[model samples]
Target: MTPGMQIRLWLRQASKTQVGVTAVALAGVVVLLVASLTTGGHHRASTSVAAGAGAATNTGQGALAPATPEGGTGTAPVAGGTSGAAAVVSAPTTGGAAAVPGAGGTTAATAAGGTTGATGQTAGPLTASDRGVTPTTVKIGFLIANVGGLDQGGFALGLRTDIGQAIDAFVDDANKHGGMAGRKVVAVKRTEDPTNQGDLKAACDYMLRDQQVFGVVDSASNIYAATQRCYTIDNKTPLAHVYALSADFMTAGGGYDMTTTPNLDRIAKFVGAAAKQMGFVKGGEHVGIFTDACEPSNTVIRKVMAPAFKADGAATVDIAQTDCDPQAQTSQVPNAVLQMKTKNVDRMFMATSFVGVQNFLTNADAQQFHPKYFASDYDGMAADLFTKNFPPTQWDRTQGISSGYSGWLRAGHGLTPAQKRCSDILVAHGLPAMKDDAANGEVISQCDAFLNIMVPAAKAAGANLTRAGWAQASQRLGHVDVAGFQSCTYAPGKYSCGDSYASVEWRKEFQGYIQISGYRPANA
Candidate 1:
């Protein structure tokens, strides 16, 4: 019998007492794991280091109120003023514009072309003069993963912190460079649990309703769509870099995704292209698809990628669904591997997390089975376990489809100007610099959204900025160029910035991945 069969027989022959004890232990472990995953880990609220003269005030409940609006500096208060009272002057009801009370009870009017504030300055409809904007500051909130109760053990610990730091660093740099349109952007940080939908909603409520930020940005989490219900559906808050979740979040009236991480359908196309490149398009190749049912996006991967591969000439396409939780993946991966072995699959596509990928690779190695592996960006092909734990021989046969450029990969080829800018900002803020795939990817993705997308949208919005104005500005964007990466575009109806991808190959020597193909249209 094969090694896999031998292990299976041994597991079957185990005594009832031993099996019962092991099952009990696993149940207890899962309980502890679930408790940790569901609870909010750590909570912190602070003003961005770059707040400078217009530093934010920490309100109760981890909310940070915008800095005081300065007069004559062209800064205007919100319609209700700082006290949140009713406006002294009402907005225009007729064709002839009526003046409304602005910051500090200043009169402002919305005109045909733009908005005119108390200072008689006619700026674009979306400018620093709008809500959360002062001549010297613009307030934004960040709901990111950080500080779990356990000692750096939660999903949001290291990776989320790195992303937050990158955002802070970029804001600081922008402040030093005269800020966005002369308004220093202050980032109010709030910790969140990615696995807890309730926590995610609470974070959104605190940021949008309580804090009253001008706009929200960098809410990176696994269950990010849950937060969208609070911001997009309920509150209509303008969010930036909202591209990390499935396409279900991008309903007509739900929320807008401003970054170019392809939706499920686009990702399926990417996978299909990679499969063809890996010689899996031949009629005789048998393919196995592994998905984590716990992840909403995985449903699309299983349903969409399978058919795409089959149509590309995969003789037989078998799919396996598994739990994504790390502990559950431990047992699920082994059984899935056994099934794959039974079918003698020549290629395997993974729609799961790094943990599931690692476990399957371990079992495959033990069984002496080597198959061409395909995975989406969800696997995070960084220098983590795939480099330190998994054998290099296995990596050599692996291929990844990335929706965005990997900073670690770019750094290996020597930091581009954009990469250098990110590093410089991190160093300037006295934060730990990006060194690994997780850190680099987090920093790069956040910075790309902030600098390339958010900044430009704000600039286009002009000085009369409102949340609605910002959303309109983002929709008008087209062919936006990202430094050290591909260009993106945005339009009405379609919120995805760039529908392109880069085919990457695993390089054990670098302990990361390298792009074998430059950015191209996803369908191409």
Candidate 2:
């Protein structure tokens, strides 16, 4: 599809609300998963979407990688099967800018390798508490996609009522609760065209340079690597972003940028470990790995995948790389299917986007070869579209690891205490309670951007209140908790929030994904 078409398709439909339409959905790309949390690790990154119900799950801004991976900044990679400029991840995908967490492994020149002190402590210009801190309040900026022009298909994105009010609701509640370290939390929000460089640059300038907020909460904006660098690296600011992250991106962030969920680079490890524990990959099972041939993805084969499964007594493993070209990425699926059938492969690791996974499954079925499919839900695997649209023949009885988004979430079940508070907070703020709304994930994610990560970290920063202090203090959260999520673990070097993921399988009769297992360490 043309990039514009891809963007439009990514915009899923949602019911409108009075405040505005809180909608976002990728009703098309059905990456079979448990919510792979590429929603980045599910790969949709759970990117931010302004379409449909405001999906908060995969805005597909993880789609925000540059034309090519460069410098220190890493691609966002939203939902697994999500498509668009924001969530491309070097592979072809469908749907519009669903914040399908863009994929593509970029090398990081920053701190994953070398020990770093704190985020935003990199070499850069200095400002007072990263330029937006004050004694009485810490100014934080937020970047969200400007869906104004993208209001097609009758989905009127409620910029103010939904997005603005939702944010205000969170901010107001935080302040009422002693705020961040007893200081009122001030948030400045800016919207920019994710696909436009000028717009992105201007937005960054306004937030990073003009507003000089202490940090930024990035929802879904597949901005340039340089633009990202401007906010976190060069500008010495910090960001809590919702994108599928990688070690390289963490390095690019100078250890400053943090993904809301598990990172893409760790998907291999998470899936492998989760599979082994779930008995999906065990001794005597012939496993097949179908993945994109990219930097970190390629490395995942030997460095992460092999060891994870092999040590579990997997008899033999076959690896295949999907074509990386957006147009031809899945060209090899047929051959890969043939190989699976010929080799008697019984288990398959869908490391590529839902596009590639669906093709492989279709080709496999054509050959009457059905191997149990499992994945980490990246590249769109765990997206709502994946569960609803995926073929039951291919998706039924499959399971994987995910930190967030799944058939359960899509089914509008499983409300956590924290999620309940989100509703209450909204209602208290005089907004509609988004119970099963399409933008439910987006709104909740926005709340977590502060409630879960930024505010808590800022609180931990205490009076120091510098960007560096925020990064260092984040570890103070220790066993971080966020309802409806399996893991929100934090550590000094761990910039991503997801650590443990739950195992889930698809239920019959189109019930979508159901969790079969609880939290397990991704590194295990």
Candidate 3:
């Protein structure tokens, strides 16, 4: 039996459920939210983020005026912008970028501690702007993970507060340095219940409609595609997402929505590449891929992942699906295990979310099946979701590829320039500097998106700060200084600027995951 099999079984019980509420309804039965979240409640006014905020509870001022879902929802990524991607920006910048000040003449430190800007292109907004931009303030929305009534303990205590402090501290630091386009960033904050689609849409609407934010920054909280659409598509606002955005969000966003992490296709592509690079999956091995039956997940499994494994020379590839049902996910695990075992799958990629990963890991062990696992940060593998559920084991031959940086992985190498700057800002605000992946690296992500990404992109927008200009300006940034990756590059359809993915491994000694290899390029 695995070391964590006992505890994993305990946590997998029905009593404790952060797996998220039913995302879809079938014949009056509730299911989904493994993806494909449901929005099936009675039509009510868009309430604020006070209803059942998760671990990161919302600190709402007041409920905004109720509104209805608007028409004209759209989709695609940088790699589809609002306009055609081909016409937007140049190809991505390769290798290290030299020091060039980000917009507003603010300097950014490179990996080697030298100063540089995200891009060298001299870009300034060409049109007049008035929406959410002011001479003194650039209002943006922050969607927080505020799970109402959940007892969030351990390093996750005050989850929302920590992120708030991290964001606020960065905002203060940015203002002190040279505000975006010479305008102070006034962030409009909203917390949402990640489990509830209604709350997700309401929170999104409040920010774009009531608060009139320039763009929405949500590094925490993974809600339904419809809610994401409410921002990037229906609202026609730019969004900086932590998770992968599907074609639904991207096409509707018209290239307005992007993840700070690698995109869906890039994630699957790199996982296969990383596994092969790590020798975890060798040529001719029968590989099994377990994924949720939802957009982005299943879509990439067929279009990106399976082909990737085959390209890596796998003899055969077996794809399995989880129906986004909490009960079905666990109940079907043994059968899935049977399939993998029967197929002699010794290399597997588990792309399921929190509950799915936890259940499968335990079941695979109980069934006497052990396969080297390849995962991504998107699986919530690096989050607190992993910390409490299980510990690393021999079977945890678990390795991952991610575009985002986590300080927990900065053991022998110390802090990167991006992490150091974020820590310093936190310390400046009387908050203890983050020394590890406490809060799973959410602080670093928020800092990266808000300070490094948004600040420069907004500045590139010049005196005007329209949504389209910001999206274009951000996508065009050739290279950027970010928290964890080797290089950060951007192009029209490639909205996220991660130029490389760092190979990480779950090390028992560190009690966390670490970067085991140097940077690997997206195209590599």
Writing each residue's lDDT as its tens digit, candidate 1 over 1-524 gives 00100011111112334333433433311101000001012221110111111111111111111211100011111111011111222211111111212443211222233443323346554344566676545777655543232222222213434555566678777666645544557776665544344555556656665556776666244233334435654566666653433343444223234544444445566678766875656677888876554423443454456777877888778766554333445566677777787778888776554445656677789888788877555434422322334466676636665655543355356665666777778887888665543435546666766776676677666566566666767777777655324546666545554366666666667555667777667652
In candidate 2, what are the lDDT values of residues 252-350, reduced to their tens digit? Answer: 454467656665556666766677777897688887776654333443344456666777778877765544322222346677677667777798776
Which residue ranges in model 1 land beyond 4 Å of their true spot? 1-137, 147-166, 176-182, 252-255, 324-327, 381-388, 407-412, 427-438, 483-485
How far off is residue 16 in model 1, in Å? 31
Could you tell which candidate, 1 or 3, scores higher by TM-score? 3
Q: On a 0 to 1 TM-score scale, where does candidate 2 land against the true structure?
A: 0.69
How does candidate 3 score on lDDT?
0.54
Q: Provide the lDDT at 342 for model 2.
A: 76
- lDDT of model 2 at residue 476? 57
Please say which candidate is ahead in lDDT: 1 or 2: 2
Model 3 segments more than 4 A misplaced: 1-128, 148-160, 247-252, 382-388, 391-394, 406-410
* TM-score, ranked from best to worst: 3, 2, 1
As a whole number from 0 to 100, the lDDT of residue 521 in candidate 1 is 71
